[model samples]
Target: MKLLFLNWIFLITVCYSEKDGKHLEVRERLKTALLQDYDKTLIPLMNSRQPVVVELGLSTMSMDLQGDGLLNMTNGNILQWKDARLRWNPEVYSNITSIRIPASKIWIPDIQVYNAVNYGENSFSDSLRNPDRHLAIVTSDGKVLLYTTHKLQIRCDVAKTVPGPGEVFIDRGQLDWPWGKYECEISMGSWTYSSSQIDLKPYLNRNYIEYLDQNNSPYLFTEDSFKDENVITCTRFKCCADLYQMARFKFKVEKRGTVTAQGLKLMKKDDKMLLISPFLLFTLVIISIIGTLFTISKLCHRKPNFLVE
Candidate 1:
């Protein structure tokens, strides 16, 4: 009976290994078939003129920097769309419903942060367009998902956007400084594709806004939401009768105690010295008066010593 049990275990392990080998073979074949004639530069659409509908979602991995009319955020962009060219019959491939592939292997939408700071053609900008940032999951039905995390440099108009007490608006862009609340609205879309090439939609509104290091964050998201048709690229830009599909996110950021601590540490040495100027001047005046008095007292008490000298 013991010998029979050992044999049974061996048979089961062999079966699993055999099944795994079959799966690996299927994956390799699928990859080759999909890419053998695939065009990575063109849009994966059945017709050339039809716009590809791309569902978009975003969440903040970290609040990297916010000041001087600029906001930098490490954000996760959830992009999903269907590509008829990538579809396959799962039955032939061991019924595998999904497979993972590097994003560089396929043609993806040319999405851009339209309002990004330094939105120019440079090395940093080129890096943003690099497909290395994402690893996509392709489904047997031709649906592809690419979740990409990027450090977005966006234009911030916190001074004008903040609401509430009038005095809060009086302080320059930084009145809130290490304190107060500010509004940051970010717009994203294909800068070159236009609405004709792509139909952009915000798929998950508030779902992806989780802060990775909440404890160390200098600002808190006071108001965050994925708005209804009310806000998803809802605000249109009319140019030459062509509409640009857009995704815009509005975040209300308030200062945390950590910001104040950092604000002091970041203060310039010159600025700190200037802060104590009045006190330093007062101390110098007191010392000067004491020294003058001591000198007078010595002269009054040492007339004989002066004559000997």
Candidate 2:
């Protein structure tokens, strides 16, 4: 027993160390990205253009983690900003031609989430109707892969994938939590969906999904797991209407809440509107004071009182 206890302690220490290391690495990268101009890394080809313009929004049902590491949206649709001028000049990347993301960039582990998928008597057709529509799994590394009988394939980073029965995938992020939703987006070719518009406040306190958008009503689980026609029914959601409306193809919308190990939500406090900045706030106050003084001075100096009397 002593030996086992020692081993467990060692393992925990190692895990903690690794987690700290990863956090440090992320912090460093973020710092570098902030300090050094990203344009410096761009190939010359991109450098010739005017200031690089980037329009960032919370993609539908997605979140955007800003450089400052703030959680910025909830709804699946919110226009963050119009073509905002990029801080880095575009001319620095003139030598670069094109950028291609490698598969290794995505990391998703296949872990079976208990009581997630639910296969019920309800027909698949009732969910949605489209061959292109199928269940896809999300991996730990933020990659969403389509589920098949054999294995999952990592499609484009932002491509939409349909869900199927007994097919469980990781949710890169969910739409619950008090502060706000996760920050990410789905960029399909030229289109983008932001999460700034959707209401994800309902998902924070609960673990199992109570409702799914596709299903028009509430979903109830019979047991932790169930097998129907070789398909497993895992969880249920109530009032799941229009869950599949965003998909290009038609699919069943089951009313069920989310079932995942981690309930994703933002804990940090977000910045206030423009008035929050000390400099801006101070400036505005000064201006208001000056204006008030000027008005009072003008009124005292002349025309008003004696002429009116």
Candidate 3:
């Protein structure tokens, strides 16, 4: 019993030491030291020639399509990049591994949704403009992450994607409406800088994409979920060499509360079977009744053949 008790005490100490939170004083000191000489206007690269490697990924919340070739996508953007200016030694501040500061005090990539339609309630440009509205998490090794939600309204040529059930489209004019799959592209990149300035990259994995511990993260929308059915795909593209470092996210959105053509056909066939089954049963019953009546009439007339006893 004594040995078991000692073992439990040791385990408690080890667990507590692994994930300890720091004090406010420790975080404040580190923040002041880092931001004192930080320049928010300039890129955080040590060498001017070296490109700032920015990692970007999205967690799609929901997708909705409109009748006018528009696709509304609600997504969460995870943007992270190393800042040479935000580095600090955790030993100086109570073994603090990370700190949070107002986003206004740091430099962030001027990312913009290139294919945005700029429609109502979609202020993509201003989403990242006001830095004071968000907080930046800076690790001891100078990694900065800005995790926030973004609403995107993109223009998709739905005519190309409008081939419905039993549809053989040879021309765009034959495309139908309100009942087909729609494909849309959300292209994001630095608005003011070229590819040489900001080198764009995708999230390292689900961990960085969630910007939290994968196992314990509350935000359930994940990259693995999208990969299951080709719902979302992220690719890096450029118009030419040295152009803007853009990443295009292409995904398909189905019509609201609708099923596939094969499914619709299956339902129709099922309905027809349902409608015809009772009639078939009734016909069989009527034929049986008529045959019984004919048998009785023959018996009544053939009585003289047997005997008149």
Candidate 4:
């Protein structure tokens, strides 16, 4: 009896040990599978170095009287100057070429010259009056791009004249009003510098400022020489207005980081079952131990011989 009891205990110990080993193997397998899935989904983003195509939209207008004379002196006529230019820095990005962007991808602003004096003036009157005016995109040494070479036509408005004593006019009235709008698209291919990598996290929610420089001069937009210095800020994939004077603009980066985050989320979700219910696992272990013990007892105990008459 003593020997039988000892054998039963030994058998139960062996069986429980084997069950624990199997559980550990299963846990390891699950961990490996999770890692494999993560690699398949997110590893490409970390290793990829391909060039990306970026679309840039620019729109701006300027209305400055060319000469020193007031609009009223010109009898409701004035020489208004409207100009816009696009530029970039070559050191940060390369291979900046103009691509033919489709109309659907371009945001065409309402190019209109408004005048309070003329209530029913034709909208296309300015374009027709100035047949030479046009928008052009010029590429320079693969560094800068210029858009809207021709000047815009704008009409001025003059205030009503009021007669005073001695035939003197109280107010000559206001001269031509300044108003114009410009919208255009430029496409460029870009990649990160070989020595540096771009971190898109900070720029995701905020605008990135690009300083401008003249194509012929080294002076930056902030300098006094570049009086028309305008800064362009890129929000996401779109940049509008005053982009010409900026030295460099930021391009929208792929959302690979977001993809990686999503992958991690999925991994956690898939492993949740294993991580959440420790109590259930404990119950399984207990049941396994009980099963092993019962098997061992049955094998070790000999059935009592039935003395049949």
TM-score of each: 0.68, 0.17, 0.63, 0.17
Point out where model 2 deviates above 4 Å: 36-309
Q: What is the per-residue lDDT of model 1 for residues 173-225, given as tens digits with 9 covering 90 to 100?
A: 44556455666777777766767778777665442355655555555576443
Q: Estimate, for each residue in 132-199, the C-alpha lDDT of model 4 and write its tens digit.
A: 34322323222211123223233322223446766543222232221111111112111222111121
Q: 194-278 in candidate 2: lDDT tens per residue?
A: 1211112111222222212222222222233122221111222254322211111111211133333343222122311122445
Least accurate stretch of 10 residues (summed lDDT) in model 2? 244-253
Model 1, 67: alpha-carbon shift in Å? 4.3
Task: Report the number of the highest-TM-score candidate.
Answer: 1
lDDT of 3 by residue, 1-309 (tens): 999999999999887766453366567777789989678999876776898888887766556566676666566787899997888887888888888888888898898887888733535566688777778898999999997776777886566533689865343225545555555567777877776678888776432222222222211221232343222233344654445666765545544333343332112312221223445657889999999999999988885845877
Error of 2 at 309 (Å): 95
Tell me the whole-model lDDT of each prediction, alpha carbons only.
Answer: 0.68, 0.28, 0.66, 0.28
Error of 1 at 308 (Å): 62
Which residues of candidate 4, in runs, are more than 4 Å off? Answer: 1-96, 99-107, 116-146, 149-309
Q: What lDDT would candidate 4 get against the real structure?
A: 0.28
lDDT, residue 122, candidate 3: 35
